[model samples]
Target: MSAVASWPVVLSHGPVTLRPWRLTDRGAWDEIRRRNASWTGPWDSTRPHDSPEPPLTFAGMVRQFNRRARHGGMLPFAVDYRGPGERRGVLAGQLTISGITHGSAGWAQAGYWVDQRWAGRGIIPVALALASDYCFFTLRLHRMEVAIRPENARSLRVVEKLGFRYEGVRQRYMHVDGDWRDHAMFALHVEEVGPGLLARLEDQP
Candidate 1:
């Protein structure tokens, strides 16, 4: 049986629901990859370099999702809308806990991507808000960090809209496109978590 065989893992506001990635999601996931190929190619690390195509099978995605789920270090979920029958959105994201240390710096890094079509729909902010809350409250984590390419203005806005503070810059932090690129570090601590996040979408114009 799969780790997420049990239903309804985590709940959040909006039609957006975070649940275990299902095998049925393969088709939609592939469509998303295909649609966003050009938009996501530069920043997405999972995109294969050799093949100008999406993964041949969902088995690879299933294996990757299941491994992270069981590993406990990371919990990956398929972002969908709660409608008539689990209608999936164009966006998918995950929360990763790494280098977990006790007392202080018990932090996890968060990374996410959205279908370009859903870019300005405020989906990413809500997802980030809920995920951050889970990290601070449910996971009992001290901090959550997001490392983004300095050139990614949209991503910077997402983190900033959520009230994350700019920490510093890491040179050659992440490999984007092909070469290692500099990244701007942003973080939010447990104490910083509050009701303010609930109003994030409302603040959007």
Candidate 2:
């Protein structure tokens, strides 16, 4: 069986710290949600309603994160940028491990989103590489896959840049922007993990 099948609360990288979500993050998280409403609406699942009140309250968000963690179905993390002993940025993303066919499949999936303000700054790549390493090294998972919308060029670039192989399109695979969207599938297997991933940020010139 893959280690990820049984592992819980695995921290991959970063002082780039990937930790459980906190209530203190509500203000910053809500602000980003408000600002990126339109920019992310087309692809994100949690866009708020037009009404004055948010559909999900701060406490609700915490409950949901905790529930998922308890089930071992997902690990939702609040990614923080640590510099000079302060949390500088938020990388909002989740890593999901599902469809456990009792170590037979040995596969899991990953997905992530960075605050738009931090896009193109290489934060996603670093976080992705760190997460990927954890899946292979710590979790002992055999394969990890990422699916991206075709229109999301920035995301596509991240996957390709990381050397995740093109695995073709998954038709109407994900519910995003309130509709079923096709995703271009990309994957990296256990054999593909290596020190090369460490050079991803450095080689991005």
TM match of model 1 to true structure:
0.79
Clashing pairs in 2: none
lDDT winner: 1
Model 1 agreement with the true structure over 65-101: per-residue lDDT tens digits: 6665565566566666444356644335433334434
Off by over 4 Å in 1: 1-8, 46-57, 82-104, 199-205
Each model's lDDT? 0.69, 0.68
Residue pairs clashing, model 1: none
lDDT (Cα, tens digit) per residue for candidate 2, span 99-198: 3222667676777777776666566677777766766666566788888898998888888888999999999888788777899999988787666464
What lDDT score is found at residue 45 in candidate 1? 58
Query: What TM-score would every model get versus the actual structure?
Result: 0.79, 0.79
In candidate 2, position 91 carries an lDDT of 45
Question: Candidate 2, residue 47: CA error in Å?
Answer: 11
